[model samples]
Target: MGELNQIPLKTDVLIVGGGCTGVGIFRDLALHGVDCLLIDAKDFASQTSSASSKMLHGGIRYLESFDFALVKEALHEKNLWLKLAPNLCQELPFYLPVYWESKYPFLWMTKVALKTYDFLSGFQNSAHKILRAKETILKLPGIKKEGLKGAGVYYDAIVDDAKLTLECLYDSLLEPNANAFNYTKIDKVEAFGDSYKAELTNTLTGEKNSIIAKKVVFATGPFSDDLLMNLGFSWKNRLLPTKGSHLWIRKNSLDIPYPLVLQTFDGRIIFVIPQRDAILVGTTEIQAKGDFFDLKCSEEEIDYLLKNLQEFFPAAGVSRKDILSTFAGIRPLVKKEGGNAHNTSREHQVFRPGKNLYVIFGGKYTTFRVMGREISSEIVHGFGGTYNPGTTLQALRQPSVFPTFTPWELSEQAVLESLSHEKVRTFSDLIHRRMGLLSLSNWNHKKSFVDFFTGMLDDMSRYIIVNKAEITKFWP
Candidate 1:
C-alpha cells in the first residue's frame, strides 16, 4: 500500500475521483484487463458516497414522479448487489406509517406503490404487506398512536456504503494493472494528442508527480461543477447540489425492530433506520452552497429531522441529547428546471467534454454499478478491448478486515489486518471508514477505544504513520 510514492507515470486510464461511481468503474475496467489508476483527494467514499441514507431500495417515492425507468434500473442493481456482497448488504423491512392526515389517507395507495416497487424489481424483492395500527405500534414501540390507520411493510436492502466502495476498490486492485492512491489530488490537466497529462499531488506528504493516460475520467459526483471549472474544462454547472443530513441516535432512544418511513408535513420523506447499534435518521433536501468537502449537519437540518422524529415518536422523548453524531452529504442531482430538489430526477448523466475526457454526474448509490458500466464499456471498447459487462458481476476478491454489523472483540490481529490490507492511512480512516465506527458515543459502549488504540500505536505505525494525538481525539 505504498500508494503515495510508488505511483506509475503512465496508465491506460486515469480516474479523477474515488467515490462509489469512480471505484465502481475502476473495478469494471480492471476486470476487463485495462491498465487503470484511480486517485482521490481524501479517503475513498469519505464524501457523498459514504454520506448516503444507507438504503438500497427502488425509490418508492420516485413512483409519484413517474420515474419508473430509474426505479427499475436501480432495483435490478440493488437486488444484484444483495447477492454479490451478502455480507456488506442485507434485505430489510421498511415500515411506512400512515396517519389520518396523511397524503395517502388509505393504505391501498401505499399498497399500490409498494406493489409497483416490487414489480419494478421483477418480484425479486420480498413481498410487502399492510400492517394494522396495533401491529405497527407493537412492532415499533413508543410510536405516536393518534390517527394511525395502518403501515406499509416493504422490503429494501441496507448497505455499508463506505465498506462497499472500499471493497470494490480492493477488488479492482486484485487485477495486475490496476492501482489507486488516496489523499492524492489531480491539480491540473493538459491535453496532448489524444492523451492527457495530469499533475497529481499527494495531499499528505505535499509530494508532486505527473501521470499520462490515454483517457481521463471525472467521476467527481457533487464536486463536478467546481472541479471542472477549477481545471478550466469549459464545463457549465451541471449539478443541483442538494444537501441531505442524518443523525445517529442512541438505540435506546426509540425502540423499533425495523426502519420507519416518516412523511414530513412538508411532503418530504424521512427514514429512521436502525443500524450498527444505533438509530440512523436523516435527510433534508436544501440547496447546497460553499465548500462541499467533509460537510457536517447544520443545526437547522438537525432540528428538522428531530422535529419529525418527535412527531412520529411522541412518547419516545427523543431530542438533541439523544443524538450521538450527525453527518451531512450533498446529492449531485442532475439539474432540472422549476421543480424543487426533492422532485429532481435521480437519473445519471455522462458528458464527453473532449475526445479523451469523460465526466459522469448525478446518480444514486444503489445504481452505481450500472452507471459505471456505461463509462467502462465505451472506454474499454475505445482501447480495442472486448468489454464483457458480466465480468464485474463476480464477488469481490478482498473483504474488509472487520465484519460489518457484527459484535467482535477488537484484537491485535484485527488491527494488524486492517492496517496491512485495508489501505488505512490515518487513525480517522481506520476508525471511521475501515472499522465502521461512525459515532463517538458508540465508543463508550464497547471497551475503552483510547486504551485499545494506545496499545496498538506502535504496531499501527509500522504499517502507516499515526500519532497518539490523532488517536486521543476519538477518545470518549
Candidate 2:
C-alpha cells in the first residue's frame, strides 16, 4: 500500500520479485519479525504467476520420474492451502481418461496411481474412484468414445493464483517494517561491507530510489537467467524456461463435470478444466527462445491445445473461434543435462552469488510456501533472528476485496477498497489481475451483464490517478 516515492532507504532484507515465491518469502520473514521490502517490475502476479493453468495439485505425472518426494511435498502444500485460503482456492475432482491404445490402458494401473497419489497426501485428499467406460462417458458428455477404457477420478485443487499471491503480499504488509512496490525495477545492486545497495526505478512515474539491505534475495522466476546476466553476475544459465499457454473458452463448450486430463500425441498431458462460466484448456511445453516477459500464446501452441482438445472430445466441436482469450507464461524449470523440459525436476534451487545475495528459482506454484521457508530461514538466521517455520501455518490475515472463484456484485465501495488497500495503481492492474478479468472478452461480457460502476472514471480518480485514455482502452 506504500507509494513508490515512500520506499524506505534501508531494510534488513530486500526481495527483488513480487511473484508468489517472493511474496511467500516476504510473509514468512515478516511473520518472524524481519524488516523486509519487496519490489516487482510489474503489477504483482501479472506475469507467470497469473498465467498459470490455475490448478494446485500434486503432479501425478511426476510419479513417472520417481519424484515421490517432490510430489508428496507439493501435495501437503496443496492441501494446506485449501484449508488456509478456502476463499481463494478450492478442491476439485480431476478425471484421467484412458483409451485402449493409451500408455496406461489398464484400469488397475490408473487405480493404483490414484491410490498412491492419495496415500502421498497421507490420505488427506478426496476419495478416488475408478469409473467404468460407460460411467466415464456418462460423466463426460461429448468425450471421444472410440477405444474408451474408463477414467481414474482423483482430487486436486484450483486456485486463484494471482489473488492468492496478492493476499500473501498484503499479509506481509501488516508488519509495520514490511513494504512493497509494483512497477519498480532494480537497475543495479552493489555489495559493500556486509550489505547491498540496490538502485530502483519506478517504471510508471520514472521516479528513482535506493535501498540498503544487509541481505538481498532474488525470487525472480523465469527472468533469473537474463536478470543475473544483465547484472554482470557470474551466473550460468540454470533455467530451461519452458513456455506454457492456456485458453479460456465458454463453459458450455465442453460438458464435462470434472477436469479431464488428456494425453497428447507427443505424450504430454493437457488439462481441460471447466471453471464457472469458462472452460480452461491448455499447456504446451516448449523451450522458450525469445523474451519471456509478458509472453503471448503462439499460434502453434494454440493449435496444439486445440488438436488435443478435439482428439479427446471429438464431438465437442471446439474450434479457434471458440477461444475467448489466451495467456502464456514461462516456467523456470531448472536445466538438467540430457533432460527435456517436461522431464526436468520441479525442485527449486537456492544460490548465493555473493555473501549477501541469494537467488531462488525452479519451483512450482504449489510449493511456494516451502520454497520461501528454505531461503528465508537461512537469511533470517544469518541476520541473528530466530526463524520459526511454523509461523506461516496460520491463515492469511489480508484477503482480496474481490475474492476469486466466486461471484459477487461489483460496487463503488469494492473498487475503492481495492484501490486503497490492494495496491491498484494502474487501470490495467485493477482490471487484468486484481479483478480477475484477463482479456477484452471478459470486459465485453461484464459490460453486457450490468452497469457495474457508474461514473467509473470519476470514481476511480478519487482513490488513484486515472484518465480518459486509460478508460477508453477498455470501453472503446
Candidate 3:
C-alpha cells in the first residue's frame, strides 16, 4: 500500500528539522561517530534559515536588552563559522553614524559593548573596530550629515545562508551512516517503550517507511509548538515569531565603501551591505501570525526600509522604484509579552517532553554550532555515553580554505554570460543566489540583467518540470 518501502532500520539518534539547529546537531553527532538519520519536510535551509538578515556577528543589538551571555556565545560562534567555512562567511566592516537626536548618540556606549564582545570572543578580535564619525563617513560617503554627531565603525560579517546550510549537510554526509533527504516528512514519532520509532514518507514518491532510534530530537523552529502539541506537553512559548523583511536594491556605485548598520528613526538597525555589484538593505520585525513559507515583504515594510535608507543616504535618495527584489523571514524570538521586542532573550532551551525525546528552541543562527554540540552532548550523556567536550570547537578551528574560488574577481558580464544556458527555477534564486547579485552595484547589475538572463534561460526545450500528472511512467 502506498508504495511502501517498509524496511526495518535502526540508529542511535534520529533528528527532525533540517534548519541550522538540526543540521548543526547532525554534523556534531556524525563527527562523534554516532549513527543518525536526518530528514526535512522541504529543501534544506529553505525556511527561516534562508530568511535571515545574512549576518554572522555577535548580536551587537542585544546590548539594548543587556543579553551579555547571548552576545558572548554568539560572538564566539561567529568566529567559528568564519574559521570553518571561509568560502561562505567572511569579515564585513560596519559603520554606525551618530546623529544629534538619536538615542544611541554617545560613542562610549558602542565602545563599551564592543569591548565586552571582543573580550568574550577570546582571540577572535579580527572583526571589531571603533572609528570616529568623520572617519566613518569617509568610508560611508552616502551617510546623512544633517545633525550627524559622529559615527562608530565596527566589524561583523555577511554570509550566504542557504550555502552555509548546504555546507553543513555536505559535512554531515561525510559520515557513512548519516544521511539527509530533502522533500521527506516525518509523519509521526511515537515512543515504543524505552526507544522511539518514526514514520517517514517521501513526499516526491508517496513512499512510506519507518525507523527505530534510541533517541529523537525536535529542532523545528517556529513550528516547535505545533510539533510538541501532539505529545501533551506545551512548549514554553519562548518564540515571538517576529517577521523580518528585506529589500535588495540596485543603487548606482557610490564612493560609499563599507558595510553599514545604520540606526533608523524608529530605533531599529538596518543593514546596507555592499556585496560585489549591489547593496542589500532591510529587515522589519513585525509580529507575525502565518507560517514561514507565506512570508513576503509588504508595502508598509518596503516604505519603512526606503525611508531609513533615505535618512542615511540622502544624496542617494533611494526609493521603491529602485528596489530589484525583496524577501522576508520570521525570527523565532522568545516571547517577551509586554516587554520590549528588542529586549527579548535569545537563550535557547532543551526539553524532554517525553521518553527519549528532546526539543530545542530559541537558538540564533550565529550560535547554531554550539547549540548543536550542546544538544548532541546532552543526548550522549542521557544515553550514558561520553564525548570529547572540545570536538565541535576543534572542528571549528580547522581551516577550509579553497584556493580556487574567488568572488572579487568575478564580473557580472562573465557570470551571466556563463549561466545563459542554465534553466531558471525561480526569479529570487536568479537574483539572490545564482550569481549572488543583490542591491549593491558590485553584487547585482540590475533587474535589466535579470531580465536578460530570463530570456537567456527561457528556452525550455532544454529543461522540463516533471510531475506525476505529466509522467506516463514511474521509475523505482
Candidate 4:
C-alpha cells in the first residue's frame, strides 16, 4: 500500500484523508469484508487528528447547553477506548477550581454539573467530589487562594492521539481488502459512469495514478469545503472553521498536580493537563484566516493562555520560558445559520454531492469511532454484507511496536520495524507522527536520534531514505 505504482485499479471505496475518521471507517468497513483504500496527503493523523488536546472525555462545559447526547456518546467512547487500548489511554481525575467571582462560582453548582457528567456515563466514570480551598491548595500547592471557593473533581482520560489513529489503520489493514498510503493524495476526482475516477499524485514524488471507486469519501475536515468545490462538485460551504492552539510546557513548571479546567475572565475554559514529561495546556477559539492545514499557535493565543494561566496560579510564576513547544489546528464545526465559532456545535454533517460521493466534517476527536458508522453501514449494505457495530468494540488486532506514556530504550530493531510495519514513508512520518515523538526532546534516548541510529544507516536505508544530514534535520 505504501508503493504508489501498485495502486489498485479499482476499489469499492476510496477515502481521501487518513485521520481518525477515515481510519475508523476503514476498520468498520473492513470488518464487514469490504475493500477499501485510504490515502492521505501526509502521514496518518498528521493534521488535526494529531493536533488534539489529547483528552478523551465528555465536554463538561457542553452540559450547560443541554448537549447531553454528545456528552454521553463521547464519554462512552472514551471509556470504551480505555478498555480496548489500555496501553494508549490513561484515566485521570481533573480538578476544576471554582472562584467566587466566576460563573458556576459556587461549589454546589459545580458539583451538580460534575454529577451530571458522571450520571450521563451510567456511573462508569469514577465518583465526583468537592474539596474546600484548603484541600484544593494542598493538592495544587501554588494556586491563588483569593476568593477561592472549592474545586470540583471528576474523571477523564488522556491518549496518544496519533498512535491511536495509526493503530486503527494498522488493524484495518489486517484484512486483505484494506489498503492505505501516507503521502499519496487524491488530487482530482470526477464522475465516471456511476463511479469516481480519482487522480492520485504522490505529493512528494509527483508520481501520478488513477483509480475508479464506486464510492469516494472526503474525511478532509476543515478542508472539505474547498476540496469539494475544487473537485468540480456543486458543494455549498458548510463549515465554521475555528482555530485552537496548545502549548507543551516543561513538567513541574507550575504547581499543577492534576489536570485543571481554568475558567477564563472571557467566559471560556482553558485546560491545563499534565502529560508525561510536560504539562499540556490549550486552546483558544477564534475565526481562522489564511491556511487551514498545519497552523502555528499565534502570539495572541500564547499571550491569552499564559495570562489566564498565570492568573490561576499567581505564585507559580509560569511564563513563556517554560514553554517547550506549541501546535494549532482548525476545528471544522458544521456551520449553522448566524452561529459563531464559540457557539457552534461539535457535531458532524455528511453531504452527498453525487450518488455515491460523501463528504464528512466536524465532531471532536473523542467520538471518531462512532462518526463513520452511518456511511459504513450504507456502504456495507450495498455490498450485501452485515455491518456489526460491535465489530470495533474488540481490541485492535495490531499494536505499534514502540509504546508511548512509558519510557523504553530506543533500539535499531524498533526503528526498522516502524518504517516497515507502521506505513512510515518519510523521516518526519517516522519520528514526528508514527513513533509519537514530536521532537528529539520527546525521545527517551540519552544520545541524539542521529547518534543512536548512525550504526544502522545501511539497514534503515531499506525502509526510509535516511542519512546523517537528514537525521540531524529532524532532531536538531
Please name the candidate that would achieve the greatest TM-score relative to the true structure: 1
TM-score of 1: 0.97
lDDT of 2 by residue, 337-429 (tens): 997888899999999998878999888999999999998899788878888889999999888888786786667788788888888888778
Q: How far in Å is the alpha carbon of 182 misplaced in model 3?
A: 1.0
Task: Name model 3 segments beyond 4 Å from true.
Answer: 1-8, 127-130, 230-236, 251-255, 394-476
Tell me the spans in candidate 1 whose CA falls farther than 4 Å from its real position.
1-5, 445-447
> Could you report the Cα RMSD, in angstroms, for every candidate shown?
1.4, 1.7, 6.3, 1.7
Predicted structure 3: lDDT: 0.69
**lDDT of prediction 4:** 0.86
- Give the deviation of candidate 3 from the true structure as CA RMSD: 6.3
Candidate number with greatest lDDT:
1
lDDT of 3 by residue, 159-189 (tens): 8776677567666666665766655778877
Model 3, TM vs. native:
0.83
Clashes of 4: 0
Error of 2 at 122 (Å): 0.5
In every candidate, how many clashes are there? Answer: 0, 0, 19, 0
lDDT of 3 at 238: 58
| TM-score for each predicted model, relative to the true structure | 0.97, 0.97, 0.83, 0.97
Candidate 3, residue 248: lDDT: 74
Q: Report the error of model 2 at residue 327, Å.
A: 0.2
The lDDT of each candidate is 0.88, 0.87, 0.69, 0.86
lDDT of 3 at 314: 76
Question: Least lDDT summed over 10 consecutive residues: which range in candidate 4?
Answer: 438-447
